[model samples]
Target: MKKNLLYVTFVNLVNGFAGIAFIPLALKSLGTEGYGLYSIFVILVSYIYFVEMGVAKYFTRTIAQASNVSEEQKIMRSATGMYIRITLLLFIITPILFFIIPKWVFPTNNHGLVSIIVIFASLDYLLSIPPTIKLTYNLGKEEFEHISKFNLISGLSKHLFLIGSVLIFKSVILLIITVLLRRVFDILYAKKFLKSMPKGSWQPQYAKGEFKKIFSQSIVLSMAQLTQITILSIGTFLINRNFTMKEVGIYKATFDLASKVSFFSNSLGMVVFPRFSSVLKRTEEKISLLNKMPLYYKISWLVYSILFLISLVIIPIIPNILNIQDMELFYLLLYGACLNAHANLSYEFLQADARLKEVIIPSIITLLMMSVIFYLTLDYYSFYAIGISWVLSQVFNSMCMDTMVLRKIRKSSSITTICFNLIISIGVIILYLSLGVY
Candidate 1:
């Protein structure tokens, strides 16, 4: 576990540097409108990739709990088959979407460029299925070091390639193609690793019963995933629909900057999820781990709070650095990201324990609330409406999940801790609104 955490940390660190370089470079090469188009393309692909429907998480949990090698093989085979079918479906759907989405979503943009980029990006995602399934299997087995090394190589290479390619070519289409080529390397590495494991073919083999079982177990998780994606993407979606592409670029850039803080929570969740899955049936162990949830929250809160302070110093400078406007979006989004990090582990814990409904319910409510807020405030707040909705909804969602998690283990609710974080979050918002610091 220690080694896994260390490797993940190193991977995220390198990728963090890559991210720091990638965005400003992208902005320089693509310009604000071009970058906005690219962001929309990426978000569209994410929505399409929802076809995955939580199969990866399902495989991870089942494989972790599997008692024997044969069982693991069966799980992998079903997963491979499921992925293949999904890939085929994407082949048919991607073209149709590329045609319709640009016209409907961004009628003013270049449809030709958007279509070409979306097609290549969709293909990149399609080609990634095999490698992703294999890597997910490794995750299920707690082979984090192996997976982290793969991520380190894949992530760093992709970013470096994008940074250099955009500098030279200044083409979003080329960037998509670059990502597709990088997947070839990923597939090779995942295949090599799978060969050393116990005998199991990568060939797709469908077992109707197994497929149904996996889907049934994963559907709730899929709902949770879809809702989460909607919540995150809604801001970009709304900004693009009702405002200028330049605003879309600014919002996405600031959101990306704030999202970096989530690296800690994301890495921690990755390491602990398998542990949570493995102990699902063990009451005492589950309780013991649940008892540690507050420590996890505090660690996450501390990291977020520290970054929140640093952001106060840095946020004002980002507009000049990135040559973008509306720097204030960073603060509200940072607060949203912090609230997200606080509840991230609890979400993972619930998912691993197959209590996904608890996770999905808050997410659904948050999405509805976000939509209502966006509707009511868009005329008054513009892009700031998106930020306000996200922060408020995240606060509600985080508290609910944390409280639910504590209740699951028969522990007293950490209302004090929850309230403390809530107070700080609210205070930050008040400060931002009253002082109007940008």
Candidate 2:
């Protein structure tokens, strides 16, 4: 396990660095108007995570089970094909439906080629297939290390292009071109994993029944996922709706800088899920190991909180970097790290056992809380309050999810465990806020 974490950790660290550059470059190059269009497009597709219907998470679970039952390849190949077909079918139909967002969502004032540049940037979302194969392999072989590695390479490559484009075209077109190119790379890299797949593995024989089973669960899971994505992105979505695109650009850029802390620390949870599922079946070690989940999560929180705080101080030195104020940007930075870790903690403890059913109770409660808070506050407070409220909701959800998960796995949440969580939580919060307050 330690061996596995080493490689995955390295990959995640690098990818985290790269994603940092990627978001900032997009905001800076595209400017505020470009960011507005991009934000709407991202938010729109988040609604379509419902289209994935939860099959991606489904694949993560079933792939491992299918491997245990018969390693020679079973439902997943056809399942992959089916998943892709459905996603593509939905993608094709997307153009026909109403965009849900207001038509006047984008600012009227824009220079030449704004529509073309922004539209191309949006097109990449359509071409991104459901990622069934990559996910399936990941669960089947516990391939998160590889997953992290590829992501690291791709993420770094993306930053390189982003930095280069800022020097070259220095316009929204550069952002558009970079995004489209990245999609092309995403597909090709995903395809590389496809080569190892069995011949004629993806026949339609296993599609209907199994896909439906996974799809049904995915409906609920997708709601949680979409809500989660919306929470992560809702700030920008609201910013675009209420203000001009340029303002959206600065907000997205600042948020992007905040988001890297999330992407980096997230590797721990990302790698832990499959490992947890594999270990759960061993009744001998089950209690002892399951007890470790919260500890690991808190330990990760402590380490990442400190590291991200340092990064927060390091990045915001440039006053006009994102065209937004440093103080509010700092708040978003803190929220991004803390909320991101908390959000991932829900998935780790709740769904790590492959029981999609677990997410229902907590997700329902969190979803409602988030919706109510956002509704009441968004119109009045704009981006900063939006970030604060969202983080508060995640804190609530993470506590609930952690309480349930600890009790279920450990049978008794010991004093030691309780004390550990208290110390970690209090410390992480204190130090994190100190960075912002200073």
RMSD of 1: 2.4
Model 1 Cα lDDT, one tens digit per residue, 1-438 = 777888777788788778877888888888778778778777876777788888888888888898998888877877778898788778788878887877886555577877776677687788788787877788888888787777877888888888888899897777777777888888887766442344664666786587677778788889888887887788888787788888888888778777787777778788888888998779888778877777677666667767776777776755566444456677788889888887888888888888888887888898888889888988898769998888888888888888777675433447666766667767766766776666
Per-model TM values vs. the true structure: 0.92, 0.81
Model 2, position 392, has a per-residue lDDT of 62
Output the TM-score of candidate 1: 0.92
Question: Candidate 2 residues 1-438, lDDT tens each?
Answer: 566667677877777766565665665666666666655555555565466676666566556555443442565565666666675666575544433224443434552243453345336555565344665666556766667556666667777876787667766556556767877887777666433445545554464576666666667667666656655675665565566667776766667666666654466666666667667767766677766766765675566556756655665675545344356655645654465575576576566565556666666666567666767886676556656566667667666666666666544554455456556666666766776643
The number of the candidate with the highest lDDT is: 1
Where in model 1 is the C-alpha error above 4 Å?
A: 105-107, 192-195, 314-324, 409-412, 430-437
Give the least accurate 10-residue stretch of model 2, judged by summed lDDT.
Answer: 98-107
Quote the positional error of residue 78 for candidate 2 in Å. Answer: 2.4
Q: What are the lDDT scores of the predictions, listed in order? A: 0.78, 0.61
